[model samples]
Target: MLKQNLQLKLSQKLSPQQIQLMKLIQLPTQAFEQRLKEEMVENPALEGGKEDEYEADEFSSDDYDEYDEYDNDRIEADDINIDEYLSDDEIPNYKLQANNYSDDDEDKTMPFAANVSFHQNLIEQLNTFILSENERDIAEFLVGSIDDMGYIRRSITDIVDDMAFTQGIYTDEKTVENILHVIHQLEPAGVGARNLQECLLLQLRHKTPTESVDLAIDILENQFDAFTKKHYDKLLQKYNISEDQLRNAIDQIEHLNPKPGGAYDNSNKAVEHVVPDFAIKIRDGELELTLNGRNAPELHVSKDYQEMLQSYKHSRDKSTAQKDAVQFIKQKLDSAKWFIDAIRQRQETLFVTMNAIMHYQKEYFLDGDEAKLKPMILKDIADLVGLDISTVSRVANSKYVDTPYGTKLIKEFFSEAMKNDQGEDVSTIEIKKILQTVINEEDKKKPFPDDKLAELLKNKGYPIARRTIAKYREQLDIPVARMRKKI
Candidate 1:
């Protein structure tokens, strides 16, 4: 059954202006400048300049009531009337602040340069190989199928089918495999292998053969599982080699690059540099925070647009054209003022939010010590600044700050709290730092397992379990102790 009832409800929603401000707050310096330029292009009444002066003339409320007749961006032809507006000499007043960056301030140059793409380099190398036209087409098609990691993700059969249907060139898996063998011999030494094992072998085979190389290949091909699991005893017995020789062979394998595509010089793509939105400096044992002025843009209403509104007011006929002009002028003025005010509020919010973060992690800022970083969350800063959690999140998500230690993403300063054996709260970041150091310094011949790591931390006053240690290790992108083995 369908039923209807009347009930009162209270709901909250963000205004368009608020939404715009939120978006502006989240943008890093580079994106923010691009956004500012876009707004200036769309809204003629809004502009960038060094002028610091602004003035306005007041208008009656009844005059503005006429604007309510039109929908947003809709101007009625018949109902439009200018008889109610002011005389030729008078102009409408608006609320606004002058937006400006200094004309004399020198612009900071961003560091970037183009690099050759990985696929393009491979194609150029393929061009050097002499082949029949059909062979060349198949080779080119195969090269195109390779991924960023320098491995062909598609099957040879799929490539063959694709070449038949899309490229109108039919080829079998054997022909594809033969050509792939040729690509395997490319400069990267492992450019076209199907899997990690094959990739490593390709690189090793390309090098001049030696006793150590032969042993490494035997280990890789025959005892990969044992070698990867660090079953050292089984490997030593099977290879009939002393621990020193196995270690040397493993070292040779370790020197080979696994991610061959990463070895490519990406000179075609500009090296992107993170431009921090904030900077923290220490003076007189005090922490000072400053917004990177490089990212901050000055915005103001266009003076010319304001003057045009005034001009329409004087010597204006009570025609639809004059009313439409007034409507357009008024809309632009409102947009400009609202945008300028939103920018002002954005600056205030960013400062308040980041200042709170700076103080929250004050100890770390003072000493540049990861151990000193306190456990903080988005809600903590949001509550302190009387803002919504989402607002604080947007500010922290993409934002970066330059500190005494080095540049860091704003969110990197936040960590969950964990208690020590003494019942004192400590940062998860500090615990991770300690855990990482222990792993890095452990004897690689026999790396510390998670349980052993937990025990070690427990001895050092951290109350953690084996599972917790494993979780932290995974978060740090470190594999298990078995994978960390040297030989």
Candidate 2:
């Protein structure tokens, strides 16, 4: 089997610089800002105005013409006044053009950013009770076990076992139980419960005592599956409670917050604003394209660098060390040129690819409808732009677009099409839409099972299997009919 073989194959691989360019193109606004700040920190040549210089240098300038001609920062350009000579009585012929604001406008527009985070909420409630460092550590350990949904899915014994093995902290069942008891009493009261019974019971314990609430808790403890599955008849005989009383208790239980940790302040977390990598505007039935301002500064081979290179080359009377120094400068100059050329190439390639996308989905952008989105993929754009599919993919990934209707992620317009029995291409997204509509309209008391849903779709001409229906349902995060059932 181990015979010598000779085979010829053609292959292509992206250079490291090309790969870096692709990653640079794909970053959205917030990440791009952070990246820009990091680059300014790293590279001395690349810089914006210093923090202290911003306020003083802005108003201390009388040469308005000079500022208009040479201003590099796109954001700072917005502050300049073009209507300096205009008066109230004068009819100004040349209107001042407004600069397009960055997508970070929404972030600036928002009032408050505080939405709850999982950890902060737990920590606040934990601080109210005093404990020794070890006890607090155990309590913190227990709090960590609770997930986003606020259920401690792992057992206390498992936590003790993990502490002894992984953390090298030997803890017993009693310590964990005491901590669990404290955590279960924390706000969003049902948090730290190991199972549904414990979660609901912890919630009920905090409620004002009534016959029905107590009875409901007992029913949940004894016949959880029946209660969950909405077997009201079996529960009625078991508990001797009327439907009205049962409904009341269920309502109260439903009102309790399942995840307390989800209610804490989540301030100062920066959200990503969809700054489009490319802009396509329709003016008088013609499409106009512009690269987003955030992509780069007015970059060129630095004039200082060019002069340094020239001075280094012109020096003839030199020692071996001087020649070596000249050679090192020459190498840096070459690298700088290559980088400048790569940047130019990147701009050109981006424009070409976006032009293709605009042409491909012109109807969708013009009208602003998902249904108008045509069947498009990487290959379609690649062929149009005269680039390989992989190259087109690099451009499309993590990019966004702004339209008259709304800003959207550019990748959303591209979806794979599935052929129907009639051989017509239909988008998989359309299929998902149909599935969502069906689920929304279905009777909750007797929800259609996956098999029934499949048959229904087949009757309506989709003709998919039960397995496929199940897969799609799961993909949509719609639980099974049994889980969906309600009284």
Candidate 3:
């Protein structure tokens, strides 16, 4: 049996131009510049930098007519007309120009320095030792196994098994252990240590022996658990030492590097540089916002391409080759126009969205006070700027704004709202800032716990719960009171 059914439904879809515009809006200043360079390279019809004065004056829409659609089979020469592309009015400046930057503006570029990696440095040091070929291979393999923190996280049995399977050099655990001991003797004192306790012990062993140093080693080897837990009274009883002697031992342990690999100059790692997309400055006690000039590049259609189209229009040839050439020219010109328009729209969208956010958090920007920030979310800014929440989110997620305080990620300004004792909406950022301040000012000898912190905040009109206080403390990377306790 055959049957036909009719079910009507509505749907929405984005055109190619709309998708391109959204992608452009999402890119920050640096990425946007890279995208611009890529476009110029791909599209010969597109040109960057200021247009020549003569070209600007002589430019006419009649020279570069846009066609609505193209046929796959062939585009007839008669279909192309110079008058069809010509407009009665002059071309808009945005369509032809994008030179927002001034000549005096400095062109800054990030500089990269070449250097060796941490593992390479360790491998080079192996040459100083008289090692056999087999020992050297094992040492190199172990060096490769060392993490950035300079610890060999794997076990001897595993390393031996891997060497047997991967490297085809079978060795016993005892031999690998001996080679590891040699690596531990390398500079940075703790480079080949297996764990934190071993790392601290290796460094202490390298120092000149003193009462405090020896006592520190004894504490680490025997009472490492008690030492780490800050069980000061128990240590004093176990060691039969006075407060001053215990303090000296504690001082030596604290001074030792827990992560020796971090001390090495690993300059080969790539550094991330943040180029702010917008800057907010206080001019005459008022916030003035400006998008980074780099975001607004001067782009225009190539004058030569336009002139070539004009020259072709006057030619008598209506051959297939000429029609194909004209069709190719139309596509590139259309792409160039769409790209320029998209860039213009991206600039406008960035400025308008950031402007709305600036006014929304004007109080905090005026003074570098975190407490002054009001409760805000993506929808709040989206509503203020009359844009979609996703659009606003894309802007906030990857963009940085240079403020008086410092360059900050835009998303840091947004936080969930919390009600105070007075029932006024406050930013969670404000509460966190105050919580950090209280912790900083507390007596380290007897640091305030979460319950006390919550009570103090309640007294100050915040009325936050103890569990919420704990959550906020963890978010701020503040340790618990037990961890914060001092000798």
Task: Give each prediction's root-mean-square deviation over alpha carbons.
Answer: 4.2, 11.1, 3.1
Question: What local lDDT does model 1 show for residue 151?
Answer: 83
Per-residue accuracy of model 1 over 178-254 as CA lDDT, tens digit each: 89887887768898878888888998998889888988898999998887777888999998889898888887788
Best by lDDT: 3
TM-score of 1: 0.89
- lDDT of each residue in 1-487, candidate 3, tens digit only: 9999999999997767788899998998888999999999999988877654423222234566444443355556567664443333334456444445675878876687777788898999999999999999999999999999999999999999999999999899999999999899988898999999999999999999999999999999999999999999999999999989999999999999998998885435668889999989999999988888888776766777767677787878667777787777767777877888787788888899999989999989998888899999999999988999989988887999999999999999999999999999999999999999999999988999999999999999999999999999999999999999887
Best by TM-score: 3
Question: Which stretch of 10 consecutive residues in model 2 shows the poorest summed lDDT?
Answer: 52-61
| Candidate 2 lDDT tens digits, 177-276 | 9877888778777788887677778888888889778876887788888877778778778778787877786676677665554433222245544667
Off by over 4 Å in 1: 1-5, 51-102, 110-113, 265-269
**lDDT of each structure?**
0.79, 0.66, 0.85
Who is ahead in TM-score, 1 or 3?
Answer: 3
**Could you tell me the C-alpha RMSD of candidate 1 in Å?**
4.2
Arranged by TM-score with the best first, the candidates are 3, 1, 2
| Alpha-carbon deviation at 298 in model 3, angstroms | 0.7
